[model samples]
Target: MNKKQWQGWGPDEQAEQHYLVQPRALAGGGDVRHVSAFLRASGWRDKSKKDGPLLMESPDRTVRVAYDPCILPGGWTIHGRAGDATVEWSAHLGRQTPVEIVAGLTDALTRPRSAHAPNVWAPLQEQNWHTRFADQNYTATSPDGAAWMQYRQDADGAAMWWTGAKDEQGNGWTAHFTPNTPMHLVQAFSTELAGPDPVMRPRGRVPHSAQIRTWSVSVKPSQLSAWQQARITAARAATWARTSARSTRPRTTARPYNPAGGARTRH
Candidate 1:
């Protein structure tokens, strides 16, 4: 579609149009704001400098989220540390990976810990992805064969769990979660990736383009889906609440929020 047509299309129409042609074309940078807003609402602080990578830290200062658009690959980084500060865990979302999917990771991060161990492979299974098991390793492949999640029980470091996605032309990206990274976070990303929901993106903004294939469709903004509408509303409300709380706080720029008496350092 032309610029005018693309600009006039609503969220749902854009999503439908994209999904019709390239179902794997996720809305990469589109949901970064939503992710940041959610983090702020969850009591994370924006510690980034002007025009630099957006750096946000959890209230307890044990976790940090970084989004650096200038980086070519692996621009999104989430790191968490143990209480003793000797061990660290991390997840990296490549620049081409959808921010919508990354938001799932952040959501899982802030959620209250569950008593039962999470089944990271369940989401893909629910979506009907083909799952294969080996001695101690498992791999889940998407229904369309465009994406995959692999787990190596015997491996350590980044190879423990890997997620990858590709377009029709073979252009692709991958995300890595360290061995020590929480399993729920991986499950959250798996759920988002496997879910049938479409991530909206303008034609040319898609992360990777097929060599010879092109597609576009347009519709009114009123066609937005109910779930997307609710998400937008909730994100905006959370942002407003966080901003209001910040504005009403006492003006003590010298000292930051630290409920614990010790120094709060980023991992």
Candidate 2:
């Protein structure tokens, strides 16, 4: 049969295609709870259609958030649209899904109406040190190959040294150390390259009686790269300003709030 004739005669095929394309209904999942909570807190009104996909409308009705639970593997497909921008994504209920729908809807509803007004700032853009560290790739390793470190300077001129090592269980531990001075960074690199070896304790009362073997680490003057020297220089000029301020701040005792719209101070 020709294509048109075959399509006209196939009721089962049409039904199958419709079901495959439609969003499946989700009974219970993390997405439902999170989305529901977000909607209620954000003042979004539910305008879902009967026996249709779940739908939420922003308070001003400028944005719409839709979820179809029929999408498999990923529990649901969330689609959000505001003005000329539209975003759609699918993720399983338990997974760390990019639920940008919440942000988009919130922005659309609360944003300033004026075109000249400044845009709303997003807190996610201000990533912490840990987040920045996770994005870095360590290009250098210690001489013993047990430790790795990365150096990064942020756009705001903040700099940090990230060091990490793996434990016996293959789990990793990391630390951020701010160099007190340029010499401090030099000493850190030197120690990593040629640090002292572990010494055994004397078994007898006379420590001098026991013979201990020792080895020296040799590093040529040319071995220190120019980049390393630059880092050392920067470290020397850098001070732990935050640490100093925190240490010098006076401690205060917090008091309970008074219903009279005033806070009671103990000190």
Candidate 3:
């Protein structure tokens, strides 16, 4: 970083004051690569302030802005750092692609039964790969349960990948992730949709959940003691269930059939 001196309210100010400007010429020419510039504001207000801009100079030598938004609540925002003190921050807003279904689950609607009104939705099934909206978790579903959506990956698959799991009844669940760009469009109410595909959830965020059978515990016993214990427990439960079932039946006698002495009918 280089520094210079300027006078007055700004560089244009008639008053004489010292100001600083660090400028660079675009390297590799237009055919090769574009150029960039960094500026530090000084003297006009306080002694030390810094600003940066990534620029693509005009072929005709005019100023053109590609994409730049400051630390505010608008598009492409960067926020949450006063001066870097090990603080955590996030950059996301509420934008979604709305879907209404009686039973289907997606990245959007996975929460309490009371969350979705029965008029439009059935209860969330565990088989779906979705979980409820957490406070720190930025996800959404409308009041009537008609509209629902999630802030999916804004970047291409080349940069990042989203992994997820489904509940027993197929409710979808996504682990929390950070935004690539400082702030991204949350895809609220409106969805940028593609053509048809069948697994029922959005093609972009859908993850295939392996069919996990609980009986694996019995199949892959970790220890000799565990296998023996499972067998004993299962045997006891089966015997108890059988006894309980038999006690509920009416008392009856078995007819003697082909006994050593003779075949005898019940009295």
lDDT tens per residue, model 3, 166-257 = 33444333222243321211121022111111212211222223332111111121233354455445444654675678699876987446
Give the top-scoring candidate (lDDT). 1
Model 1's alpha-carbon lDDT is 0.73
Error of 2 at 128 (Å): 4.1
Provide the lDDT at 144 for model 3: 22
Off by over 4 Å in 3: 1-138, 142-167, 170-176, 180-267
Please write out the lDDT profile of model 1 over residues 110-152, one tens digit for every residue. 6566788888889889989999988677899988788889887
Better of 1 and 2 by TM-score: 1
List the global CA lDDT of all models.
Answer: 0.73, 0.36, 0.25
Which tens-of-lDDT digit does each residue in 1-267 have in candidate 2? 689656633443331110110001111122243354445444557888898777777555645556665554323333333335443222112121212222222233322343443211111122111222343432354333443445666767576554444423433334343432122222223232222333211122111211223223332223323434553343333324434676999879785657896766777
TM-score of 2: 0.25
Candidate 3: worst-modelled 10 consecutive residues by lDDT = 20-29
- Show model 2 residue runs off by greater than 4 Å: 1-31, 38-43, 50-52, 73-267
Assess every candidate by TM-score. 0.69, 0.25, 0.15
Single out the weakest 10-residue window by summed lDDT for candidate 2: 18-27
